[model samples]
Target: MGQQEKVATSLAGAVSERVSASLTPVDEELERRYPGDPGTRQPVHTVYVPGEQFAADTIRSWGDRALAALDEHAPDAASFAAVLGLADDLAEPVYTRVRAKLEREPIEDLRVDFEDGYGGRTDADEDTHAARAARLIAETYAHGAAGNTAPYLGIRMKCMEAAVRDRGIRTLDVFLSGLMEAGGLPDGLVLTLPKVTYPQQVTAMVRLLEEFERARGLAPGRIGFEIQIETSQSILAADGTATVARMIDAAEGRATGLHYGTFDYSACLGVSAAYQASDHPAADHAKAIMQVAAAGTGVRVSDGSTNVLPVGPTAKVHDAWRLHYGLTRRALARAYYQGWDMHPGHIPTRYAAVFAFYREGFEQAAARLAAYANRTTGDIADEPATAKALAGYLLRGLDCGALDTAEVTRLTGLTLAGLQTYAGPRRGDLTPSAK
Candidate 1:
């Protein structure tokens, strides 16, 4: 095993050693650990990695380096698969397996992209006009030529501030319409309205899409997508904080996801120099709020990109640093554990992030809770007895450094209520997350 792979495996195995050693079935001792109804626990988690997460960038880059190294020893490079595959019968390596699977066959839904706005302009000079026209043609074709089955795509409106100040156009209505057509906002398209200082901005944009969808002969329900929650106003007044909910209500079903407008939101927070949403303290808190607001409802929440943009090759020292620092590793990973892959590259991390977080720690705790509720083995499940057992399991897991509540919910379906009553973590509540 490589040094990095060895580190990850040894750490994970060491953390899960006790559970692995005690594959012991639920018995009297187990019942005492968790007095709960049996057979009630469900496989509550579903994979939530963004297909095109920056993590994908990380994985792909890592794969490139891995393939380069492996090809030296083994020929048939294209068919060789991942580095872990090189080690036959050498299973139980999560990092290598996770990295390989993500790099080779990236999941579908995890991919999300923001469409750049048009830079069209009127110019008297022949050369200038030609340059603008070329850009327009290139972008128009680019959108069309790109692969379909979009993980998710959001189109930003061209600079309305410039349109208003320089060209004296106020509403951006005509410009937006033209840009939409140029970008091919056909049926089932999700449009993102940026720089929205007020709810009305979003509502008006929502109306445009509704009208456009109808004009295009697209079924109304065949549409209804989402937008990014980026602007300073939107971030400050998240969900319950402002007219954001009203804007969402206006969107009808067209609004399905909300992304933290990291850079812009951070600027609003008065950070001296602008930084990407993932880096700022405000971004973290805002993301939590947005996440909570979208929770339970079907609306998905996404964290903004690392805007530091992967420089150099993947698996490089810088990429590792980005993973460690620039990324909200624990929070984002926790969300992944709960089945929300907010970024594309994050999808691969989703598997490990989730399994490592839950595995025996979350799952076992939940299973023990379920076993406690079962009276078939003759012990009754009462508030007093069950709470003690549940508390005992939680304290032990917490002491051992395990704190995933969503898994607890899966085990008992009673976690939320318990959380509300006891003020304990629910649904992987490392801290009050999901705005």
Candidate 2:
């Protein structure tokens, strides 16, 4: 075999050797809360979902009333927009108040997303606008434009049927790739694959992109894709996510994340359209799939948007939903490692949720990962005895910084001379609890 193939094989062996058989289980409380099966090891990355409508006024942009229903309201009501983090390009009046109220918000971990082409009309040509968005995002993000925190681009398509359309659904392939290639796409683009149904649709996507990368000479898989679990197929417990999960699993190294389409998932089920999906049974079922997907796989999963309900001017309504958002944010924070937002107000909540969720727990997870990464040349261990687990560990460690030579020496109890017995030094991080 050539050198690269040899290197890969060597890595596989080293990781296979190091992980321990007997270890403490992760917290059950966390397991119940997150549905991660205590095995999914994907390194967490937080992102802010964009609001459906950015009100011209800043008041509307910050926090709006929730779609959560009261005895009086209809069940099909739209939710208040929980703005995770608003765009820096605030409307003058709205900006002043929102900035005054929420300035210097502790927001480093959150990624603020910009809406690309909302109304059916593309601000630039549909293709051109997408490209422009890619360019602008990279530029602005690099310069620390969105108040120093990175700004991402979310391409919310102009609905399935819109004017000045994409013509056919198949054209999404061209549209997305064009956008990513328009400028070098950033790590921040959440290519929200909305309204996904069949496994073939996803598989076809992976195949098409593989072909596109070859033709364009773009390095393989630089652009990561996220699937929005929206349709009835995703919401119904009986309908089953097994096919979709298999699709994501088949993606292997390609999919970056899975986001639950809260409103869409709600609508798909007979859940009242008026409210959000936080406590709904359908959303819970969807979250279960998310937990399973992330359990042993390295792919990250996210909860979906709290469709921009108006957190109105009334102190009673505003504070009530704000508190509700706070509670829901924490619930999602605990349930999954991540979630979505509609208004900019939601960013602080998301960020806080992240800090609360991981500040303490992540250190332990990081510590455990370090322990795994440091094992010696003879440290053969097995859970399921699969190649994927070993492969996963290497990738996870690489992302989370738990693997290095020193840790290897400590875990293996091997000296430099002893290391020579192995063909070469070990490398790569292991994945999700060595499953």
Which is the leading candidate under lDDT? 2
Model 1 misplaced stretches (Cα beyond 4 Å): 1-93, 107-191, 237-241, 274-279, 308-328, 333-355, 358-362, 365-435
Can you write out model 1's per-residue Cα lDDT over 14-113, one digit (the tens) per residue? 6676775665564544443333222111111121221122231332343344344333322332222232132322223334444444344333232122
Q: What digit string (tens of lDDT, one per residue) describes model 2 on residues 294-394?
A: 65444566766565443454444445445535645455444554565554444433433333333234334333433344542324443223223333333
Lowest-lDDT window of 10 residues in candidate 1? 38-47
Taken over the whole model, the C-alpha lDDT of each candidate is 0.41, 0.44
TM-score of each: 0.49, 0.55
Stretches > 4 Å off in candidate 2: 1-117, 122-125, 146-183, 235-241, 250-252, 308-310, 314-334, 357-435
- The stretch of ten residues in a row with the least summed lDDT in candidate 2 is 71-80
